[model samples]
Target: MTQRHIIRRVRGVDTSDGAGVKLKRVIGQPALDTLDPFLLLDEFRSDEAGDYIEGFPEHPHRGFETVTYMLAGRMRHKDNHGNTGDLGPGSVQWMTAGRGILHSEMPRQEEGLMWGFQLWVNLPAADKMTAPRYQDIDPSAIPVVHPATGVTARVIAGELAGVEGAVRGVATAPVYLDLSLEPHAAFDVPLPEGHAGFAYVFDGASAQVAGQELARGDLGAFSRIGDTVSLRAGDAATRLLIVAARPLDEPVARYGPFVMNTPEQIHEAIADFRAGKF
Candidate 1:
């Protein structure tokens, strides 16, 4: 028996920075509830300096992890911890905003196109106030391997090509990957037996997942599917960002950067941040 994939193509709106930086947000603020503990996802790819130069200036975040993966150009980032670095093509930075932190991502667009995606993953209630941490992974460190079907995969948070990523993250058992399928090629991505997985297609020109159809800018959220995801590309090569999150099975109460199980917990996060606690 084949179960129908309940898929939704969410057309995200365009948002402009006060500094005139333009980008598309798949999930944020108003879309927060839809993403649960995950607060937001932003895609900033631009050839014009005006569209990205503004960058995300100094901002505060707490109770989550922000994963920034660059596909092109460069991002100069600095945080309150005095940790500063530059992110170029294929680089990944996962900053765990356990307690609180202030940081900014400034564009160092030496090339024409500055492209990247930023995703916020929530922390479990017990670890919300652990500490602000980071995993600065360079492109060379990421696994870009081809196991089968002429498909190359970038392992970030899980296993691909039997080569897992080097990021030592939380215990939720999440999986994040950047996959590229050669024309007419196909492959299967392994996931936890009962985990939740989804594919976000930035270019929907020609792509399909787990026998389910998907278009550009579409998020194909899987239901009670199998453990592996089968994918194929069209005439042109296809690129997709795949992620699987563990089911916390707990209440999710969120307010901006703070994600807790209760309103008062969120309020405490705010007060703690204002008290210079990070």
Candidate 2:
């Protein structure tokens, strides 16, 4: 029998990021601590242009991967590696800042709603200094599936009902799914045994998880004892992002844009970035 993972905690996302852009930070806050192999999850949703216009200026990152998924508006990104791309609605950009990278993400539109999520996944010790890479995925390339009546899923990094996601070759073996459930609908997703998992509710009211209610803009971090997660929609429809990943279980040394295994490594990353070695 599959054990239903219970929601161990529920918390709100009230934070700001990248030049004053208001965002709902579901996972990276100090209160929640850190989920191994997954460092951060920030959701930015705003209709006012002033809220996001400043955007994320050029920044340096190392020893991790950043995954950006846009649901609305447009964002253009440029990296020091001469790679440039635009992210439209439903698009995804998975960047590996393995060794190091300097990049900027700025909004393309002056007005209108700009909504999206950015997730930071930590790399293992052996792969921390590997070369950077990217997986630029268009909306059309992402596979969508109707797993059951009134339920829709967009697979981003794992297989759902045998429908594979576009992202591949990730070290963490992550499962990222964008899910929508109608009123009173129920969905159960099987996860790899022992992987850490969580869900962030973005739209609608509540989700019933193991008999507990998780409200909007709230994150539900699951207990590690279950092989499957079960959720039931409230009276209204609900939209959420669910993710699971194998834990690295390694020491974490973080400073600003760098995440390394030791304080000495973080120092090296800073030195390399300042010396223009990225």
lDDT of the candidates, in the order given: 0.76, 0.88
Q: List the residue pairs that clash in candidate 1.
A: 204-216
| Model 2 stretches with alpha carbons more than 4 Å out | none
Candidate 2 weakest ten by summed lDDT: 1-10
Across 1-278, the per-residue lDDT of candidate 1 in tens digits comes to: 33324344454568864256687877673543355445677788789887877787987887778899999998898988999999999899989888789888888864499888888887787887778888999888988888786688888887776787867656567788888777788876777765665688875366868776667776766664567777877777778888877766667777766777788888887887788876
Best by TM-score: 2
Q: How many Å off is the CA of 3 in candidate 2?
A: 2.1
Candidate 1 whole-model C-alpha lDDT, 0 to 1? 0.76
Off by over 4 Å in 1: 1-6, 17-20, 29-32
After superposition on all C-alphas, the RMSD of every candidate to the true structure, in Å, is 2.5, 1.2
Instruction: For candidate 2, give the lDDT.
Output: 0.88
Instruction: Give the CA lDDT, 0 to 100, for residue 274 in model 1.
Output: 84
Q: What TM-score would candidate 1 get against the native?
A: 0.90
Q: Indicate which candidate wins on lDDT.
A: 2
